[model samples]
Target: MQRNFEHRKVALGTCGRAYNTPCIHEHSCLRCSLLRPDPQQRGRLTEVRDHLLARIDEAHREGWLGEVDGLRISLAGAEHKLAQLGELTTRTATVHLGLPHFSHLVGRTVR
Candidate 1:
């Protein structure tokens, strides 16, 4: 898992829930709802999203309607994952709470 996390960020996002089974999504990790995306993988995820956008555009230009639909689904999933990563950064902003003084609580009694 550690090696996968370090090296295969583009192809696989960590799934803490899955055990001893091949991915039912056939390694389409971005489109799989079970995927747990790592914020550290944001660069790779953005690349994937950009590529998907180019493919969708190409599919439209080539009149590949079925291909376009499938690409759009994957695109939506990729975008959702990107949004999750965005939220993670903002949500993890730390607010420091300094250590409490025991003296302050020493004489305090709970009612």
Candidate 2:
């Protein structure tokens, strides 16, 4: 039915790589290709993790993070903190690298 087809489509989109279509032939389909993680993204995530861990360590050394429960909460929040830091780092890097800000570039007429 239509509902089944729609569900299949959504599942395919979520599960597969954007440009990679499932093989139609049996032989090709048998040899399934694995999607590779983006190296830059992996590197960025590792960098973020290390930086956050170091900050947490520094905070603990300075008595900023108190008790085991507080440490657990801080560890749990590290991913969210890293995501926020990543966004800010990306924005700052983009600006520092001389790329015009999206807002500044928008609606400007070129002479």
Candidate 3:
């Protein structure tokens, strides 16, 4: 006599829900899994950029071209540095979050 058994596969991180193809973890639920900076950091950067622009505009309106030009250069440099930092943070977050999966794969391959 032969017996057949059927195995049901449960989605890995969704507690038995149907698997979502795009996200293997199934936790994103329609959201892109991109890392975003903390709200405070985002708000602070916006505030600083707005304040610098306002100051530059005020200096220009008062006929202070030298100050306005200096502020413009400074703001541009600061914005560039902020963008670089944001990129670094995002890369770091991606690597950090992926470490567990990477380790699992490594373990399986080594074994």
Best by TM-score: 1
Candidates' C-alpha lDDT: 0.80, 0.44, 0.51
Best by lDDT: 1
Q: What is the lDDT of residue 9 in candidate 2?
A: 31
lDDT of 2 by residue, 1-111 (tens): 655433223211211333445544322211223222232344554564566567777777877756544444544443454454456556644334575558968899999
Q: Which one wins by lDDT: 2 or 3? A: 3
lDDT of 1 by residue, 23-65 (tens): 6777788888777798778899899999999999999999999
- Name the weakest run of 10 consecutive residues (lDDT summed) in model 1: 4-13
Query: Residue 33 in model 1: shift from native, Å?
Result: 1.3
**All-Cα superposition RMSD per candidate:** 5.4, 16.8, 18.5
What C-alpha lDDT, on a 0 to 100 scale, does residue 96 get in candidate 2? 45
Model 3: residue 19 alpha-carbon error in angstroms: 52
For model 3, residues 1-111, the per-residue Cα lDDT tens digits are: 122122222221112332333445344211222223243355555666688899998998999999987778657744754564567566744334443445545645532
Which residue segments of model 2 deviate by more than 4 Å?
1-39, 66-111
- Residue 3 Cα positional deviation in candidate 2, in Å, after optimal superposition: 25
